[model samples]
Target: MNPEDLQKLVTMTMPYGKHQGRLLADLPGNYLNWFAREGFPNGELGKLLALMHEIDHNGLSDLLKPLRGRGR
Candidate 1:
């Protein structure tokens, strides 16, 4: 995915729940894993989270480090 899309995923706030206002990318791995087990939510946000999960799972979070550093 493009950096802008990834940035939006990383910085977007959760609309609800205990982790509300937290960045999607910053959500704990266990939490995301739980979602994977239980199934992700519906719509674009869910898609983004699933994508983030894959990225994080592959240990390529560093690929986004530059974008994060750029403050996008």
Candidate 2:
């Protein structure tokens, strides 16, 4: 995964859907899991979702903490 992507998770908002406008980093685990089960969307959004899913799945979300503050 690209290091920049970790930062993007904090910076980027969900472009569409029930979570639209929410930060990717803040999406609930259930939401991410739904994507995993249903298949992530295409392009960068999908990749980021997959990455975030992995992070959440393995309990490594704390690794993103240091990057979160930079977004604001």
Candidate 3:
């Protein structure tokens, strides 16, 4: 993934869904896993979700902490 994508994960909110307005990095693993089990949407949001899924799945969510701090 690109460096900007890592940044985006911490900054961008989910545009739609039950998690609407929730930061991508903050989405629960189950939600991300749901996408993995089902299918991700099309476009950049899809890509970001997939990436976030990987991050959550691999237990690397903590890696986004600094990036989340930077957004403040």
Best by TM-score: 2
- What shift in Å separates residue 50 of candidate 3 from its native position after superposition? 0.5
lDDT scores for all predictions? 0.78, 0.95, 0.91
TM-score of each: 0.81, 0.94, 0.93
Better of 1 and 2 by lDDT: 2
Model 2, span 20-49: residue lDDT tens: 999998999999999999999999999999
Runs of candidate 2 with Cα error greater than 4 angstroms are: none
**Model 1: per-residue Cα lDDT at residue 25:** 72
Candidate 1 lDDT over residue span 1-72, tens digit each = 666778876568777878888888787788888889999999988888898889888887777666654454
Per lDDT, what order, best first?
A: 2, 3, 1
Candidate 1 vs candidate 3: the lDDT winner is 3
lDDT of 3 by residue, 1-72 (tens): 998999999889999889999999989989999999999999999999999999988888888887776845
lDDT of 1 at 17: 79
Worst 10 residues of 2 by lDDT: 63-72
